[model samples]
Target: MKSSAATDNSSHHVKCDKNNINDDGNNSFIELPPNSRPLEHQIAGHFYDQSKTKYGLLQHSNGDVLKPLLNPPRGPCEEQFYIDVFCQTSKSKYNSEDLINLRKFLPHYLGTYKCQKMSYIILENIIQPFKHPCITDIKIGRITYDKEANEEKIHRMSKNSVVAEIGFQLSGWKIYRSKYYEYHDKRCVRSLNKTDILHGIAYFYGAPIHLRLDVIELVINKLNELQDYMKQQHTFVLISSSLMVVYEGDDNDQELNKSTFVDVRLIDFAHVFPQTNSNQSDENFLFGLANYIDYMKQLLDKNYVYVPIDKFEHDNKTDTKIYSCYKQLLT
Candidate 1:
């Protein structure tokens, strides 16, 4: 995830026109009613050949924009597995647990369909409610900071003040060392340690340092909870992904006010191995998680100054326990 899964297809009746390809021989988007192009994005073709296919938001003229994806499932069974998972995990066991951490780990899985050489999953186009929202999207990967694009991001975020400005949108996941090391620019993040494993961490929005600490703490707690849940449920094995931390909201507001929106989610599921048919360890989640916290602590210091509970209490009136979880995750 450079800041998301697979499923069955025979059951669903859908088709893609293979003839609808561009002159480049790469696949083009399926022929459909003409729609508006994305506000600012590349029109990437969708024919994944073990190559990283670019995923973008399908902004439609009808004002219905959605996050689009192209990736293979773990196998034929992959699609159905997540469909069931999404169904079971759709709503909380109790309304009171609406803020349950289970749903917080991944983007809202809208649904999926198949076409020529690709399986597309539709997810909630994660956008802020603000008229002009600034987004900082980071795709977490198994690469260390020294050898991946993360180094550039770190440098840019640290020195650039506009990164924190309102109306800024920060989106994109971390780079993969094994898969992306060669094809992607050298500036991408890579594993610096002798071992090839890289843990995931957030920038804490860079330079400011204090805010970085708060963001990192929240991220750690979220990862801790998610890692624990995955192990218990045995849902799936995350191999290599550009998982990300999304922060959106007005900047001028108090720190906690930013709590209106902050999420930790896997960007894509290209390397996700379903545990249903395999014996993959959930260790990757835990390992990456701990590594992320440690990496940040070494740079920003481990001590955390309390982000008052009242900061988010305003938004979580009905879910006071969630507010408690926020405070506890930090402590």
Candidate 2:
């Protein structure tokens, strides 16, 4: 189990246990659980093609034969970079009795990704799913580290000095990767794009209409719960990009109900503040809130709220009720 003292000061800690790791020596991998639908690998061969001249084909996960074109050599001319994919993991088994008690107290930390592509790939590939009009064919290359350079980068990041630079990295990655998919299914809602607001409004107004209201409510409730949890720890929540709250419908009956379990996800923390930074002040909180408001306004101005639906009749009033509830909360 990897633990961090810094997380103790945060409102909540995310712990990733041994179960999360499929470790073989220094190479650690986490295999996402099999969903009812196939878990697609969006990057696949695309990663191999980037900077083909450098970072020669190291090795594939499957010992399959590598074609010459697939083999790229790593060289100085190649734009090498690193990314940290941080997540909380547990040290004990899933059913271990210790987890029952320790789970409540575990803290979450940022996952690091060491990758070669520009930082924007992080947003397009990782953050886009949570937003509207989901993107695809985005590949994140391998992770590596330049000890001296990373040390400097980390020092700057901790002081909130490199925020603008980080933002630039995110934006650049987004534009470069946008070529793969110009547009996605309107219903998917990729991120906080204009289409997302429209979809959110449609989901709210079209209610009494069957949709995933519970999932949205679950997410809101979880955020509230996380907020309270963080308060107890004397930490504040920061909105880096957008958060995702998910609920899985019953496959057996194909019905969505409160009984369905909920999963809340916080995405794109490029702007999140670490509790380790003692320099943060109340002003930071206000700034974060202002940013959040700006985002919320974008959603509302795009008709994210369902104004027409309140006029209709429906059995499940929960959608409108919850939307109204969050409207006030967000404002």
Candidate 3:
């Protein structure tokens, strides 16, 4: 095994004083009389091994009972086994932002027995993606490294570190590489996919009916906020995949009794891009905005109230009701 220059050889050795003897030839260790020192100071002296200067219980503290180390400690063999296993498994796996995110679920998936009984297994199996989503449902397979002989070909267009191979029940299996612009930072290498979106949608759909309007508005508000942020940053925001939006919470202040605003978040940016003159034109923006306005109008017609804003807020109950009515007409 490779060793670091700072490794200490004496760390493994145990030290004890043998000269303090009793009548039976055992160590004649005696606790300090109560008045000799403060109770805490005496307890600290009894617990701490003064000869080694290590913090540990003394043999005489519990009437000659050898108290174990207060802090649970792992044996050297177990520690080495964990390090070796972690290194080997990490090397074999592909690296990606999504995969890193998914890796957080590994501990719970592996279970306590595997984690405690075997140190090597805890590092090895937990680091690798499970065969089924039921076992490892984090979409890690979408960013796995290819072990095939032709891996070089795949690496040329898509760096092995940022891409993952994912299997879909409907499409059989496919490998999608992260667009170069998406993972410019090394820390952004993880396999986030459409499954994450579907999960969010399902969650909102199952939310209580009382919260549906708040949820929908929250989703719309988030997109608007992202648009505003992008405008400020002088970057165009594009939602390439349909699953970019998620409803998180209501936007109301507790102290004030006014209607709360909705909260939304964008995730899995593997496919988002800034609009350019060649790809996005003024006409395109107007067309897209018109379609979006129409969609929002439909929602309003259906009694789905939206946060009222200056210039954007509709007046006249007839016009407001038409917004929801238009939504049903399109359907």
Q: In lDDT terms, which candidate is top? A: 1
Candidate 1 runs further than 4 Å off: 1-33, 36-57, 60-81, 88-101, 113-119, 130-186, 190-204, 208-211, 253-257, 274-281, 297-331
Which 10 consecutive positions of candidate 3 have the poorest summed lDDT?
Answer: 180-189
lDDT (CA) per prediction = 0.39, 0.28, 0.26
lDDT of 2: 0.28
Model 3, residue 319: displacement in angstroms?
42
Clashes counted in candidate 3 amount to 20
- Steric overlap count per candidate: 41, 45, 20
lDDT of 1 by residue, 180-202 (tens): 21011112222112221112122
TM-score leader: 1
TM-score of each: 0.50, 0.32, 0.23
Model 2: lDDT of residue 316: 62
Better of 1 and 2 by TM-score: 1
